[model samples]
Target: MKELFKQIPSVDQILSKKEIKDLIDKFGYPLVKDSVRKSIEKVRDEIKSGKLKEKIPEMVFELIPLKVEEVIKPSLKKVINGTGIIIHTNLGRAVLPESVADYIKSLSTCYSNLEYDIEKGKRGHRDSHAERLLSTFFNVEAATVVNNNAAAVMLIINTFAEGKEVVVSRGELIEIGGSFRIPEIMKKAGAKLVEVGTTNKTHLEDYANAINENTGLVLKVHPSNYRITGFTKSVPAKDIAKLCKQKGVVFAEDMGSGNIYDLSELGINDEPTVKESVNAGIDLISFSGDKLLGCVQAGIIIGKKEYIGRIRKNHLLRALRVDKITYAAIEKHMELLLREKYHEIPVYNMIFKQAEAIRKEIEEFISGFKLENSELEIVETSSKIGGGTTPEREIGSFALTFNLNKSPEEIEQYFRSREIPVIGRIKGERFLIDFRTILKKDIPILKNYVSQLLSH
Candidate 1:
């Protein structure tokens, strides 16, 4: 290696335009000439520092070119959501329906009615598209949307209670997924947070005692990411609303991960519905469109027409307003929910799929995979409503478990890096392909990918 290094010229001689172009051709245009030029510059700097022992510079030239491609590539890309964690936050929570996608694509190329009232021939509200549908679906007097649930809370607090006290249960001051804690948001919104009780227990008295002349709002936040059990107490939205009404304070319920449908019929734990919260006579109720509602990234506020009107007039509403694409998608999703087209929403379909159908699908796929003397079994597994919803509920599911020649981790990584990633769980030293969340159409694509990987 030392003799080979001696025979090679200085670092400056190796990086010619032709050589760089050759490397560019090998790696696609994503890397190309810019990466090679930068790598060459790095090597020159390394040589000046007396770090080049011939082979080191060549190695540096080779390595830095590869690193540059990775450094410049966009962090966001499409990944198949096969982890069975529907609403997987890290993988872009809440996959929009095909109708929503088509609508977004249709409006992208042309001018839209986003801010124009066609009937009146005048400027219009951006929330007009989704507002009526949301109101009808949630049974509220009116509705408005912001970019996300966090922003929705911020807008409400800043609009109604900035520089005033907002009382909430200590248990309800929960941290949502992604470290977005409620207290932090309240502080940033310029509202003073008054904690009312212990983490596991909070009473209506806690809220009543916290209310005083300067208190502007009574906030009740749902602990979406976690649940407390065993000797626990909570104040219902109705009770809080009554208290707020008597005290002349604004009532707001942060219905985190609020779903419109009843999931107990689908064998999942019972979660509070948005309509129920609204019927509690609260001044305002806020929930996420992406989680249980199964829509786009939106913070939906539904309440008394007057309060929603105030929220709409807030200056921050402009900064947190949803765009045309979001309005289109949210409108379509709400329509589907109202029409009872439950199957159209992928998250609902995955969660509510029958266990028997999942087993049959797994059996059919297993029959196609001739394992070459390897043993495979369609074992019963459990699915979950991940993305920090329903932490304790496990749905019945089926999985295809096989003993592969490659290590389980290696096979898992292979699927992860494949063009269409197949994320599944590994159990008892075997990779388990859970079929509850896997769509029927995805089965063939998965089979082909596995066959290709095993063949190589």
Candidate 2:
């Protein structure tokens, strides 16, 4: 055992090796040295446990760099989403349009008038960056942006309903992705959550009876992730707005998945657009910029200028405000939407995609590549508007499926472990790469990776 320990190279000796020098250049000297010390200690422990029988210096040299990289691999990386779910929250929620991404890069690398008013030759407010574009889409008096919808809700509730009763329906108290519950957020904002009506139904009179002098705001939360069908009834936004007006209370809606375009033209008619919510006489409204808006993550609030002015005066606004890059992304995204270039946006492109086009692309890919040890076939699949947008509405789509000797889980892991990881879904016994969600530029990359995978 003692001789086996001696056979393992010293940390200093390993650090001096030429290949180790290459690792130092890549990972820096301090990290490489720390990794070498830990590896040496691990080798000593393995020898003490009688796991090593001979000098394996060659094996150690061959694996040391990989060990160091394993310790330093970044958790966040660019990955391909083949799951047919657009606006996938786990996969970065929304992908910026190519033009929007390029705009952000250009603005970020240099400097722009993020706060400068070149017209006035003085400082300007950053809210105008996206707020101006959003106002044209709705009849809103004013708008402001925060980091996310949750932050928007918290900020608005704190601004108007703190230490007061916030009347809401028990049916509308939704919990979206990551366990973000409506009641919990209201509590954090110091609002008294007074849940009214049943889990399946809520009426206009229920809200009217709940309001009193102590009532500050009536919140209507959109069930963006789930649905209750059959024998269910809910109050319309206009009726609630009228009731709030009569009671002299603030009425706001957390209209999740802030859609700006008319998706009904594309055969999706379930979700109501942000413009409809604005025209419903709602005194205040907020929605997510990432889900259906096809932009960066932002919580946009628009309503009466009086309430917006009050919100801007709140000290918490500073904590919840977005940075320059986020403003830049949202502004450019709004420009694309205003131009009616829906295809330029990733989320819209996926929603607007036809199943036939995806099939043709899959056929072309198959004809070009020679993948061994796997059978490729085209399959019909369904895509979804994920990130809690429109739930249960399956859009027609297509996938390139693979049937290999490996198990489904093993095949998924294999693609997931690639340099640019491919996240495909396993349905039945086959692995699927849905073309509806795949970007046009990524098709060649997918073909090359699959070839390398099966050729081995």
Relative to the true structure, candidate 2 reaches a TM of: 0.93
Tell me the tens digit of each residue's lDDT in model 2 across 1-456. Answer: 766766888777888889999999999998888877777776777777888676657656766776788889987899999999998888998888889989889988887898999999999989988888878767688899999999999998999999999999999999887899999999999999998999999988899889999998999998999999989999999999988888899999998898776777657787888888887899889999888888988899999989998999999999999999999998888888888888788887788777898899899989887655447889998988888877878888889887777788888888998889999999998889998888888888898888876776
lDDT of each: 0.79, 0.87
Q: TM-score of the candidate numbered 1?
A: 0.88
Query: Which residue pairs of candidate 2 clash?
Result: none
TM-score, every prediction: 0.88, 0.93
Which model scores highest in lDDT?
Answer: 2
Report residue 311 deviation for candidate 1 (angstroms).
1.4
